[model samples]
Target: MADIKPYTIAIDEERLNDLKTRLSLAKFPDELDEAGWDMGSPLADVKRFVKYWQESYDWRKAEAELNSVPHFVTDIQCDGFEPLAIHFIHVRSKVKGAIPLLFMHGWPGHFQEVLKVLKPLTEDGDGVNYPAFDIVAPSLPNFGFSEGPKKRGFASEQYAETMNKLMLKLGYKEYVTQGGDWGCHISRALAHLYPQYCKATHLNFNSANPPSYFTNPILALQHAILPYTSREQRGVGRSKWFDEQGRGYNSEQCTKPQTLGYALADSPVALLAWIYEKLHDWTDSYPWTEEEVCTWISIYWFSTAGPAASVRIYYETTQNVDGRKNKLDHQGLRAWSPGVKLGFSHFPMDIQVQPSTWVRTLGNVVFEKEHESGGHFATWERPDDIITDVREMFGKGGGAFGVVKDATGYAS
Candidate 1:
């Protein structure tokens, strides 16, 4: 195995300057007199983001902040398969005998989302509190700093296997896994393929169950009746609706990501508007003063990872769905993990899916929770509540057992 090394930011100042010049020269599409985001990112919003990126956004500062975390890159030999190299940040806990935990991120999101939780998890001596655990946040292969996969057939299942290799390379015998969106699917696969290593799995979204079961009469009746009767169920349904409306980006990414990638990959402002729009729509309805949303966009814009990251969804989903039916078959699922145990921390302001029916059919759900506050970006939106839930779920006397392991015959 090749030794892993610390990665340094090496972006070219000239390239950044070129990006600004292109943005300044862009010829935008025409819109109606009262045009707005109903079509997509409004011209005004894109202009604001471009101005900020050109005049105010500091790539070096953001790079320094990201570098503050301890990060490493390692190469793994996958037997006969091509070698896969992985990049990850390890945040150590001040608490003695801390457990190891692996956190994953989904599409349109990255390792930055978890930094809020990472701070409290790794530090001590302040009011911050959490179960002591070594935290590992990796840029999913082909996403951020992680090297792009060498093979063409890379999917969520492949991502799971790669992550499993990553854990084994790091000498973790067992660990807990948590994720949302694509991360949720990959974590579920990790649990299914390597149950011995995956002591427990937790998810934010619970969409892993087979589609056939969703149409089953009993489940259908439960889905229909439950929403009317249960407040949580109703919230889940509403959340689903909101997600569908806000998910235009997903549809585009899953289908024609490469076409759109040309623009996003080249222009920082374009990438900012593309990602920032989702952050605004999905986060808690609280008014995000302009600075806050731009701050998040600045991270991705400066990283120069916007297009590479977006195309991953196209690669994964296109491999799974093709141009055929929406329903996923068992064989198709076997390519990924089958299902996962789910947990929820419902914030009063954020809409969430109910755990009862969702988890029982999905996987072995060992924990379900309801918190007073927080939203989609739990770590960033409400770090304390997220910390509390994570502690309660994975701590001693917690809902699940042992740490997660890898299925590819690798160490935990």
Candidate 2:
């Protein structure tokens, strides 16, 4: 096991100046008459953001705030692959016997997603009868301060291996997990591959396909016979709209991420527009401040790995999308993994939100919550709800109570 080292966020002056230069020289595109979201992110919105990013947003101040958070790094190696220097924020609870919790972030997200829950999840609860956790939220390879692979074929399996090994290296022989988007996919992979160590999981995004008769006859039948809930019906519509109108990025990234990477890497405007669209569309009408948006994008601009490295996971995972050969069977990750307790939070505005029957088929569901609002970035947008779902699933009388042996994370 590699020795763990302290880590901090600091972008040099040259890079900061280059970002400003790029922002100043960015070209503005034409917009259609009153073209709103349907035409992708609006030109007007992009212009407003670019002006703020160049003139008003303070990158130095944002850096100090992010640096205020404690971070650490250690090398994790998977068999056959090279070792990777993984970056993470490790916050321990004041309460002894705190449950070890692994938090993972997905695309268009980084370790920053943990900011909202870092305190509540790790602090000793005041009078509230709930368990505290020792939280480990990593910047998955290529996404944040972490390093990325130059070689190809580092898919979900590799990601799971990286996270699982990190926990073991940190002396967490057993742990639970929480995630959304790619976080959901990676946690599912962890539960499937390392059920012995990863005891349970709570996820926010919809990740499973409808159960099939071959594998899940009972669930498949129930899926066929039962009437969809009003929420489920609305979810179907939301999913359909995303499929038709919002999946352009998915197709492009899955096939030609390298080509797209240039635009993201070289042009600040391009990168901002690309990610800003999702931030707007994927949320539940949450008002985003100018500084918040800039800081979010700035992480990518000044990431340890260049902005381009962040998008390669898309291409690597879906290289066989053309069906020439086998691709990463993402659907396989969603299949039931026994001995692993499962929990899910259904955020109404999340991309690809699924019906209960579909999500329930994912695994041994111990708890679930269907929220009236929230979206893909649920950890940031609805931290309390996500933490509560996890707490309820692992607390006393909860389905996964006493799962981690002597570590129940409660006051004696």
Candidate 3:
């Protein structure tokens, strides 16, 4: 492990200006009379966001806010393969007895989502109470300031292993993990691979299962009727929908991320639209009233990480698509793979998928919760609720294996 160094946020005005020029000159595809997001990201929506980003978004302000928090960069070698450096922010709680919590964000999301909660979490009564935690939010390898993985083996499973090594390198023998989107998978993978190091794992989505002797009837039914049901089956249904409508980006990334790399890597607005559209759609909230979403876009814009970071997912997951000799299984991700156990706090409004019994059959679910509010971006949309749930689930002295029974009599 190399010594951690303090990090700062600095923006390149010239690059941003160039990005604005490109957005101004972008040749948009013509929309059919009935055309809309059903085919892909709505052009009107992207245009509105781009207009706001160019006109009103303040990158320096967002940068200043980010700079207020302490950040560090360090390298950790996984099993002595080679050292991989990572960038992370550490918001130490002033409150006594704060537990260390590691928050992970997924694709189309950077550390910005978690940063929204830092101030409230660290302060009490207008001052530092530093309640309950020293939060560490790192840009996963190949995302943000963290260097992209050197080799082709940096899958989510490998990411889990790297994160465990990172925690150990930081001297956190045991710590709580919280994630949403892809972070959920990586966190669960961490738990699956290093249960001893991960004290507890919490997720916005639960998608994997342990090997099972018998098929779960309920899950089987859900899987069988998913296409006809009003409720969307996460991962699968979403992937299908995306493949039909929203997957152009994924297809491009998976097949030719390098080709689009120049545009995303160089153009800030392109990067913003590439990432922002997902943030808009994934959350329960959409058509983010300009001010609401631009703050997030500004972070990427100023940091100039829009394109480079966006491609990390492509770099990471492309192999899974290309290397498979057989047709890719679109219905579900491979279960029984070594990774974290997903815990879902199913929200009523969003498309929710229960953890298949297949998952429970293989591994133990140490903690689970069902909250009444919030969607994909839990931390940003409902920080207090998310923080409360996190504290309750991972609180010190909270043992693993606590049974969580939902009102429906579901033991999740």
Candidate 4:
């Protein structure tokens, strides 16, 4: 039997009532007099969301809107973990020679991040000079509509395995990828583990250490002689700020997720504040409407694995099982994969934006661009920018042109 089947977003009425009931009975804590965002989510902002979530927010309308996209689910069996019903959106370009592109989303973000780029990436390229793509954006195992793995230790390698297998099952022998946040790490893991199939990768976030004298003599020389650009300096400050004060969520999620998961799973308010804080802090000054904010949280609130399962990835990826951390699991995830071509775009507001040279340390650098403005959620906030970079990288005479050989990424 074919494991892949079409999916529709239909939440049960009882779950909807449960969410409203919980939101109604939520007990909120007091905030300091002038505490803005310096303290986590402001009491007022959350209270507003709670009111909207309970009274004004219509999940059925949101579900109908999401159903407009093409979604499918299939069983992906990882080595250690059981077979999971993975959810994905596969939009095939009409162009016969279109390239297959797998887009991945990270924490606090779901496959919906790929929604904005879908029409442009798959439709707008017709008769245009740029190449078109057969897009596959999957909600990773345990996130969105995908079923979660019940076993422990399903880290990046397992994620890579599931994604790679998903593409292969769809008959894509080779493909390219684009992402930020955990998408960056998971795509990097794919390039590392399955370099044979992942021909090239384009990333908005670059998480890598500086070149070393012993291992990267030439890059180290450049690092020693050249001063960081003004933008790089600011980026360093942003990263430092994150390391110091902004990354409390990471610690809790990575070390003791279950303890935190109880609150996330049980309380609608806890889940709202937990994800809402990231949406606010991770983006540039992009004005977020109430609908946008609630739509995002509601997905998690009604995810297949429940809201709690998503955070376990932090623990699985970080905690060393038996003190044996796989290359795709830890710091080694950002390491270079020899056969894959690379493209990098630097946006100022991303939490860990690195210098162009530093990003080059990660792989065979082919394409690079610096956007005037953008942030971690580049796919949504800067959709055109992300799509332009991909077209430039794989377009005619572009650096990665014909990397997948017959897949020209263009219509004849």
lDDT of each: 0.62, 0.85, 0.60, 0.87
- The TM-score, computed over Cα atoms with residue i paired to residue i, of candidate 4 is 0.96
Best by lDDT: 4
Task: After superposing candidate 3 on the true structure, give the runs of residues whose Cα lies further than 4 Å from its correct spot.
Answer: 79-82, 120-131, 209-248, 301-306, 318-342, 348-352, 355-362, 396-412
lDDT of 2 at 190: 87
Per-residue lDDT for 310-334 in model 2, tens only?
A: 8887777766544423233576777
Question: Where is the poorest 10-residue window by lDDT in model 3?
Answer: 403-412
Give the candidates in order of TM-score, highest first.
4, 2, 1, 3
In model 1, state the lDDT of residue 27. 67
Cα deviation in Å at residue 381, candidate 4? 1.2
Model 3 C-alpha lDDT per residue in residues 205-307, reported as the tens digit of each score = 6555433335455555655554532333343465355446655666777677778878776665567667766776566653357766776665555443344
Best by TM-score: 4
Query: What residue pairs clash in candidate 4, if any at all?
Result: 131-409
Cα shift from native, residue 39, model 1 (Å): 3.4
